[model samples]
Target chain A: MTNPGIRDDDVLKAAEQWRREGRGVAIATVVQTWGSAPRPVGSHLVIDDKQNFLGSVSGGCIEGEVIVNAGEVIESGKPRLLEFGVADETAWRAGLSCGGNIRIYVQRVD
Target chain B: MRLDLLADLNAERAARRGAVVVTDLADGSQRMLRENEAASDALLKSLNVRLRGSKSGVHEHGGKKFFVELHRPPLRIVVTGAVHVSQAMAPMAKLLGYDIVIIDPRDAFATPARFPDVQLIVGWPDNALPSLALDPWTAFAAITHDPKIDNPALKLALDAGCFYVGALGSKKTHARRVEALKQMGVSEAKIASIHAPIGLDIGALSPPEIALAILAEITLYLRKGEEASA
Candidate 1:
C-alpha cells in the first residue's frame, strides 16, 4: 500500500478529538484502488459536519464527493461504499486526474 | 468505526505499537486486534503477513470480505555498541527512514560527541530496551565485541522477534557466544537466527564499509524477509 500523506497520525486523532468536541464526524478511507490511484489503500480523509477535512484519500480528487457522501452516512448512521473512476460521469465532476479508480468506505464515528 | 475503537487505535499508535481494525465489508462490523493478539489466531494467516505493517486493504477470507486496516509505527533500528560502525550507521540508517538508536552502558563510548545525530542511550540494554518496546519494525545489531555488553542485549533482541538481529564477531567468537547464549536460556533456534559474522559479505574492511554492509543487510531483510509477501 502506498502512503503519500504525512498525516497518518493526525487524521485519526483529529477525528477522535472532533468527536469529543461533540461535532458530527465521518471517516472516509480508501479501501481499494486499481491502477495509478492517487492514494494507497487505507489512506484516510476525515470529514466533519462543517465540511472541514484533514488528510486525503485520493490526494485532491474525489474527496469532495467522499465528503458529501460522508454527510449522508453521518445522518443515516449507515456506512456507504463509493467507487470513483475517470470513467464515471458523475465522478467526472471531481474525477481522478490520474485516470485511476478508487473504492472508498465512509462511516459515521459513533 | 466506533469512537471507543478509534480511541484505542489512536492509543496504540501514540504508544508506537501496532494495531489493526478488521472490518467485515458485508455488514460494516469491526473489531480491533493488537499485534500479539493477531499471532495466535491461526486463521489469520493472511493477516499475519501484515503484523506491525502499515497497510489497509480488503481481503477475502473464508469466502467473505474483510478490510484489514493497520496502524504501525515507523521502522526503527536499535544498535547496542556505540562503536565506530554505529557512528557511521546512524546517519546512513536515518537517510533510509529508520528511527535509529544506539545503546551502550559505557559512558566512555556512547557519548554525544561520538553519536551526535542518533538516539544514544548511555545505559545497559537491560535497563533501556524494556522502555523501547522492541517490535518487529525494529532491526537490532550488537557489535560491542564484548560479551558482557553484547550478550545480554542479544538475548533480549532474540526474544523480541526483531526483524533483523545481527552481531559482529569472528567464527571462533560466535561459536563461544552461541554457547553463552544457550546457557543464558536463548533457544537454539533463536540463537541460530543471529546473523553472526553480520552483514552482507562484500568483504567490508573499514567501519563505514561495515556500516554500509550492515545497512544493506537490514534493507534486504526489511524488504525481502517477512514483509516480502506483503
Candidate 2:
C-alpha cells in the first residue's frame, strides 16, 4: 500500500502525498508507446529523490532507467522525455525487452 | 503542472469528474481541462473522440505535441438486491474494475458471509440509495423483484441519470412496475427508460449466466451508448 488510507494503485494520490511530505519527487508517465508495449499510455511511475518509487511506466521494463532520469528532473524542476525501444543496444539492459517502443515524460511535482 | 492546478485536478478526480491534463512536451507547459469544460475547448472534436474511448495518449496538432492524460472516475455498480444473482455479480463487477454495492433491507440476505469484499448496504432503498450518490458513471440494477424495494430505487437511479438502469422482471411484472412508477409521479420518459427483462438476450438460466448477461448489457451501454446515440 502507498499509504494508510489511499488505494494502492492511485499513483497521483501517492505522488501528491510525497510532495506534501516535502520530498523532491518526479512523476514519470508513459506518454506514448508502440508495438507490444508492456504498460498502456498514461501509466505513471512516481519517484522520490531518495530513489523511493511507486507505480509503473512499463511492466518493469524501463522503470529503473526512468528513475535514474527522474533524479535529474527532480533536481532541475524541468520535465524530460525519454525513449527506449527493443532496437536500441540497451534493449536487453535498460530498454524494453518485449520488442516494444515507449516514450516516458518525467516531470517534477511542484 | 502548477501546484494549484495539480490540486485542482486532484480535486476534480476526488469529485468523480473526468479531467484531461494537456502537457506540451517541448517546454513542459500544461493546462488541465475538466470533462464538462471540454465542450468549449478548441480541441473538442479530437478530445471527444479520445474521451469516448477513455484513453490517454499524445495528440499531435499544428506541429505541437500535447500529451492528453485522461483521468476518469472509476465505474460503479449499485445493485439493489443481495440475491443469488448479486452474489454472482459481485466478483465479476470487481474483476471489471467496478465498485459494486449490494443493497438489501433484509439483514439475512445482506450478510457479509454471502458477499465478501463487496459494499453491502443493509437498509431500505429510500434510506440507502441517497447515500450512494448514483451518477452517470454508475450502473444501477434492481433485482430485488419486490416492487416495494425496487420501485423507489429505480426512480432514484433514473432521476440521477445513471448510465444504465435495469430491473429484473418478466414483461408482465414490468408492466405492473411501470404502473407503480407512474403512480409515484415519475416522468413517462424516465419510466420508459428502464431496461425490462434485464440483461442481454443471452438465454441465461443460471444466476451466474444471468449476471454475465446483465454485465454485458451494462458494458454495451457504457461503452457504445454514445456512438449509438450519436
Which number leads on DockQ? 1
Model 2 lDDT per residue over B173-207, tens place = 99999999999999999988788899999999999
Which pairs clash in the backbone of model 2?
Answer: none
* Alpha carbon lDDT of each predicted model: 0.86, 0.86
Please state the error at residue B194 of candidate 1 in Å.
0.4
TM-score of 1: 0.79
Task: Find the candidate with the highest lDDT and give its number.
Answer: 1
Instruction: List the DockQ of the predictions in order.
Output: 0.50, 0.45
Model 1: per-residue lDDT, tens digit, B1-63? 899999999998888788878889889999988877766655466545456443567888889
TM-score of each: 0.79, 0.92
Alpha-carbon shift of residue A87 in model 1 (angstroms): 4.0
Q: Could you tally the backbone clashes for each prediction?
A: 0, 0
